[model samples]
Target: MVEFTYVVSSIIFGSLFGMMAIGLTLTYITTKVPNFAYGSFVTVGLYTSYSLYRFEAITPYLSAPIAFGIGGLTSILMYLGILRPLARRGSPLVSLMIATLAIDIAFVGIFGTYANYLRYTYVFIDSLNFTEILGDFSIFGSQGLILAAPLTLALITIGLYLLLTRTKFGVAMRASVENPSLARVLGIDVEKVYVFAWFLAGGLAAMSGSYYTLYSQGGIATGSGLIVEIFAASVLGGLSSLYGAAIGGVIIGAGENLLTGGGISVFGNGVLDYQKGIPLVLMILTLLVFPQGLASLPWIRVVTRIRRISGRLLGGIRRLSARGLRRC
Candidate 1:
């Protein structure tokens, strides 16, 4: 049987990764720019949950809603206060990307200050490892996270699917993303859609971060540390497809955990230090092999090619058998 810890770890990480990737993809689709500071929104959620836990003795899970709200507000501020204004001035895509990078750099200092404040006020370490503080119940000799994490991800996925496919707002959001000018002509509030998209993106990222704090150590630099993995997942899944992003995040997350765990078992604990490189390598491979990403692959053509090859091999083998029988 697979180790229970590995299973739980994979599920938690995959679910959180998927959530973050979806958020990143959402903003990218809406604004056509990758938000480098998106990771900071995650840190906002982490701190929000941590603060609530420390001050009110509330659980991180319970504080997720607060984290979502704060994260959404922060994202809105970034879009309205910086990105929108720059966009109005007709900033180039590179400039907009650099702007996000600047926001990320600013967040490092901002979060660092917050961490220092927490240390001075609470008289406790700002770095968090919730392994001891958060209690878990056993299910089939495994931790509850195995169930909770994946279930949460599933529900969120379903909710998003319904919202995007069934709701009028979702239709408007899609129209806005497809063509803001046309959406405006159709009397849709394109700007409103963009604002909501950013808000939703940040909210999802923060919620994921709240969940992340339960299993991993979180600190001021946690968001910075995770940004690369988030980008990898988004790129691997195809930035244009939210569902693809979700799938990519889960694959990367699970692959990273399982491969790292296997490496550690064979190569000792030193291998753990290289865990981050797994996602980076995967991202590089994806870009080189499938620039358009997994979602854009022609699956029908691929399956047909596979069947053709199999048929050819089978025919060759039968011909060889008939020749052997005739010789006998």
Candidate 2:
């Protein structure tokens, strides 16, 4: 029973984390910048929702967009108004990284200074029934968010994949990621692509944050250390692949929950609170084993990429072959 509860809890939380991580993965994939401020974006999102909630004029679902938009707009403003301009002036990568960190600090200060700020409480929905993976296992209300958020994430993932592969804008974004200089030569608006990436990242992150508030009645900076957790999941998912990051978030959530549930005498048999270290440990282990990530494994992700690329290359060759055959 104990094991069943732990595993169930892990899966629910893990999936939710994955949803929260999608934008982080996207931003990192395109920008090649680990944007430590990503968590702050989440903070922006939650506060955005909370702000609307205060007015008694909005519902949770509606407030979600309000939060998401605030985070997204802030990101757009930063990229268009600040970061892009600085980088255009020939700023180094290290400088850019530091600038992002500084922005986060300033953002947090602003959040703290607010008179009636968003505070996502850790405890909410004390009990709720959910689709259990096993027998008769129940979950907390927050656990429901764990499930719902990931479903939203899956939709977002499909949407993003379409944007990256099917849409012209997505291709341009991918081209920018591959080589911004070359992409610019090919007539891609590299600046716009980057700005779009920032907005998307911030907007999605905010959705996650607001969703977090729904799970926990948040009014404080519950997102302070979120970057580290996101980073660890990103490492697990595959630093270079968005899909990998999402997967990593799920695994991190599950593993941490399972490990801490055992009360294995770590931190003097502390209850699940020590689960916080699971992501860190999984991160170190993952880096040591599959530095490219689980998504890079032959059985799942890497092989598929190889096949897709191969199919495209061979299709062109086959077309030429048929043309020559007809001419001959």
Candidate 3:
């Protein structure tokens, strides 16, 4: 039963992580920057839900749309007020990256201030846990999050697929990302596409964070603390591929949870202390071995090799069978 719980937890965590990674990848695709402030956008959503819960008794699930709107607005502000202006001024990529880092630091201060205000205005714990408030149900003896998280991820994936493949704006966004100068020459509003990209990224991040509050203990620094894992998942997936980011996030999340649990069971509780290191290790190993990431692998070539080998083996077996028949 404990193991079953662990499995459920891992799946839920993986789904959430995948959602975050997809957002991160979207920002990277549009801006060509790591967007160190990405996690802060997540916190923006977390606190949005937190505030609603504290002030209005609203559930996080119900507050997701509000969180998405606020988070998207915040992201747009960052891009327009900061990144866009700097980019227009011909700032270097490193400068843009540093700007995002600075924004992240600034957000920490902002979130800290907000948290302090909430503490003073209302009596509540520093760490927000909505497990009881969320009222998660059991489906086939498993926790509701086990179903909800993955279902949310699937819906997001399908929505994104339809948007990118079916919509005119999506085509323009893709073209802009692929070649901004060409897109501009073709009369596409590259800047508009970028703004929308950042908005979507922020919205997705916040929505995931809102959901996260249902299962995890969240605080002002919760999103900041998760930044490393989010980056690890993105890098492991191949920063260029959104689909890869999703797969990478799931792998990282599941690997971290299951391996940490196994280590604790085998080596005792002391192993729990190193749980955070799992994602870092995964990131480092991925960089060393598959620098282009799992998405860039030669999967088609691998499949062809396997098919050729199987064909040869089958031919050899048929020849041996014919020899045996002749002898008979």
Candidate 4:
């Protein structure tokens, strides 16, 4: 039963990790720059949840929308006020990535200051480094997040798929992603598409952060700590593919949780401290072994060969069955 709980927890955590990473992947696809401030958006969402709970005493469920809105608005502002201007002036991808880092640092400082203010003035939270203010609640003999995280991930994945495949705005966004100059020539407002993509990315990151508060300790360093894991997941998944990001997040999540939750049985208690390094190790390994990601692994050719063989065997079996039936 304990081991089972670990599996469930890992799955939920992985789902949330994926949720945060998809936005990073999206921004990378559209702008060709990884937004290092992406995790800061998650930090904003975490604080948004904290503020809502402190002021209104509401559950995270109620605060999610507000968190998402604030996150999206902040992301849009970052793009329009900073990134857009720099990009227009022909800033390189490295410069844009550096700008995101600056944004992350500035945001972290602001978050820390706000946390201190709340602690000093309202006495709401005792420590910005760690807080278990709203402890986890259960549902159906499992943690509420066991249900919420997977459901949220599924909905977001499906919604994004539908939006990208079915909607006009989504089509325009896809066009912009593929070729901004051509999209513009075709009368697509590439800048607007970029803005909307950033909004969605920010909103998703924030929503993931809100869920993170339910399971982990909330603090100023929360986002900073998570950024490494988020990047690991993104890089593992094939940085250019959103679905790959989701898969990468789940893999890292499960590995991290599985190790931390049950490593004492397998490798003894000393492994706990090493748990934080799991994602970093995975990131390095992924880069070394499959720099193009699992999606582009060389074994894909072998798999395709096996699939074709199986397909031919199935067709042969059907043909033999039909021949026997005709003979009968």
Tell me, by TM-score, which candidate is best.
1
Per-candidate local distance difference test: 0.86, 0.71, 0.87, 0.85
Per-model TM values vs. the true structure = 0.91, 0.76, 0.90, 0.88
Rate residue 299 of model 1 by lDDT: 82
Clashes of 2: 9
Clashing pairs in 2: 118-219, 119-218, 119-219, 119-220, 120-218, 120-219, 121-217, 121-218, 237-244
**Each model's Cα RMSD:** 2.8, 11.8, 3.5, 5.6
lDDT string for model 4 (97-196, tens) is 8999999999989999999999899886554765644655788887788888989998888898899889999899889998889999999999899889
- Greater-TM-score candidate between 1 and 4: 1
lDDT of 3 by residue, 207-262 (tens): 98888877877777778889899999999999988889889889999989898888
Tens digits of lDDT, candidate 1, 190-308? 99998998998999999988877777778777887899999999999989888899899998888888888887778888978998999999999999999778899998999999999
- 1 or 2: which has the higher TM-score? 1
lDDT of 2 by residue, 1-328 (tens): 2465676667655765676567777777766666877788887866666555554635445677777788889878877776778877988989889988988888777777552222333222211111111111124633455456667778877888898899999889989988989999999999788778888888887887776665544433555577777778888888777777778888787777777766654444556555677787787888899888777777867679889999999999999999999999
